[model samples]
Target: MEGLELTAFQIISAVGTARSCYIEAIQEAKKGNYEAAEQLIKDGDEAFVEGHDAHSGLLQKEAAGEGEHIGLLILHAEDQLMSAEGFKTIALEFIDVYKRFDAEKKEA
Candidate 1:
């Protein structure tokens, strides 16, 4: 609708896409598709940067004494952002483990 609301939606949408990409990346890694998994991680990083930039804009506004009322939507967007970050961490770890497994399998 308006400023804060629109920005919150943007954060949510971008991070949601990022979260999905991270999950899909894990799936690809599990299937031994390291290149695809890496590509998805790259895609997720791109989306995450978009959301992070949007969130930074809000922080900058607040720093400039242009703070607005923090609504539930904004709170939810922050939560989504945190969740996506956590998922990315997990995805990277999983990919590493899967890569190790694949390498060991090939050796065996």
Candidate 2:
């Protein structure tokens, strides 16, 4: 595969992994494993950032007039990027709600 294709694949892989981490974070919270959930969220953010950086590199290349041709793979990578971002947001909210529930239980 070409360099661009390889880069796109890497971005998709990283972001998809991040997405999974974020989802697992929510699941862990449901199981009352707050610490594990928090750690997963942190891991997810790290993976997402790496993917974002790779994606940004393509954007910079395009801006510099060394445009990378568009393909379905690249579009898919963007989809994964957006999905990861959305998952991260939802995961954070879920964690907060879980924390509140835990607090309530403690008060009881």
Candidate 3:
């Protein structure tokens, strides 16, 4: 827990949490619990923002010529961030589809 490794770990933890939440949200939506799904989505977004902020700090430092050492851990953190972002998109889409199915059921 020092220097760039610390930051990378922070990013990885946050985004990994986000990805878990996003997947859980989809599960909740599948169960027709839209409220829970939405809450999970919110939670995921918060975690994603935290990770994004940590990543941004690194970018800022690099731009200021105080670049940190690049390593596989940092790359893994970036990969997790992107994966979480993609999961968020997928979760939202799944939620919408679930809602539509619920609506149709109610109308029938």
Winning candidate number (lDDT):
1
Better of 1 and 2 by lDDT: 1
lDDT value, residue 107 of candidate 1 = 100
Judged by lDDT against the true structure, how good is candidate 1?
0.99
lDDT for model 3 comes to: 0.97
Candidate 2 steric clashes: 0
Native-to-model Cα distance after best TM-score fit, residue 88 in candidate 2, in Å: 0.3
Candidate 3 on 33-73: residue-level lDDT in tens? 99999999999999999999999999999999999789999
Each candidate structure's TM-score, on Cα atoms with residue i matched to residue i, is 0.98, 0.95, 0.97
Q: lDDT of each model, Cα atoms only?
A: 0.99, 0.94, 0.97
Q: What is the lDDT of residue 58 in candidate 1?
A: 99
Order by TM-score, highest first: 1, 3, 2
Between candidates 1 and 3, the one scoring higher on lDDT is: 1
Q: Lowest-lDDT window of 10 residues in candidate 3?
A: 1-10
lDDT tens digits by residue: candidate 1, 25-72: 999999999999999999999999999999999999999999899999
